[model samples]
Target: MSEYEFSSDAALLDGDWVHRTLREHAYWAHDRSREVQDAANAGSRCFGVYERGTGRQVAFARVVTDGATFGWLADVIVDPERRGLGLGKLLVEGIVEELDALGLRRTLLMTRDAHTLYGRHGWEPAAPVGDWLVRWRH
Candidate 1:
């Protein structure tokens, strides 16, 4: 389901299919316009997966990083129609490679689902953030 192509010159960050893809992936997406605008402007490193031959995006993921030691994965999504295809793993594998290239040794994320997928990549549960407000009320 996923085959990531590394591109430093990513397509410009814009609303473009950001929100639509979110909805298509069954994420509780609200305010399509806002979701698109916010994510595109968040300044995170984004990985976009395109369907072979068609060049249409089938998955999306973003990583917020410090470019040195840490990268936190967030907002990983794959279209519902493509769910059984292993697209999510490809998105993450791409992010891992990018962060590794940038010399980041610590990659982190919080997920309530897909634990087995992450575990397959050798990630294990660790202590949660110390007194951190991990949720977004927005």
Candidate 2:
């Protein structure tokens, strides 16, 4: 209902927002602050959507890639209250743009329950998934 803006600057990710995103990812990140700081320090690609006036981050996504031919999406989260408001789609689109910029020919990601959401963005289950053995997903 309010103005929405998206940015790729980690500077936009404040402590409170970083904490919330990390808490939401507690399952995968044993130490959230470390992850946030690492991402910042590594110059990793990250996306955040914020409320207009407050600049409060409400959605976030990041990618790990070699800036070449492959891209992996990680840490994509939309604030529960902000879910279904198109932030996720926007974030993924941003990631796609990043991949294009990197000259990547293909991108890969795994989502437990967001197949449909990712499908809306043209991502579908890869056939012959047998190629990559299921190890551990975190």
Candidate 3:
């Protein structure tokens, strides 16, 4: 098993790293402004995955939850340099465990290419493509 450690400490979140990774790499939030990113981090239950000894953040995920019945997982990203190290799976697993502790009955996430990863963690396609609706504002 990998030695990475997962944390739910918003204080441990490296905002600059999160912002840069999302802006430069993640397709979903590439256009998000730094202020918006900060706001989202502030509002969600942010998780940070760190190197075992260095304490450097290498992965991140967040959940917006009501602390009971519903959670929406978002912004799951691993450092590009650390991809294939199983940190993504570790991050997701940690998030799910936290959510389960909250007694959340439903958790949701949208991914363009990671269906298989999430499936292993008990997530299923909540709706078929074109059946879900969004009201994204720019």
Top of the candidates by TM-score: 3
Q: Which candidate leads in lDDT?
A: 3
| Candidates ranked, most accurate by lDDT first | 3, 2, 1
- Greater TM-score among 1 and 3 belongs to 3
TM-score of 2: 0.79
| Alpha carbon lDDT of each predicted model | 0.68, 0.73, 0.90
Which lDDT tens digits does candidate 1 get at residues 1-138? 324343323573334566666655534554456656475537787777776566667677777888888878776777677787777777777777777789988788777888998898767887675744666786
Query: Best to worst by TM-score, what's the order?
Result: 3, 2, 1
Task: Give candidate 2 misplaced runs (Cα > 4 Å).
Answer: 25-27, 30-43, 134-138
lDDT of 2 by residue, 53-95 (tens): 9898888777777778777777777888777898877777777
TM-score of each: 0.75, 0.79, 0.92
Which residue pairs collide, candidate 2? none
Candidate 3 residue spans exceeding 4 A from truth: 128-132
Question: Which has the better TM-score: candidate 2, or candidate 3?
Answer: 3
At residue 90, candidate 1 shows an lDDT of 76
* TM-score, cand. 3: 0.92
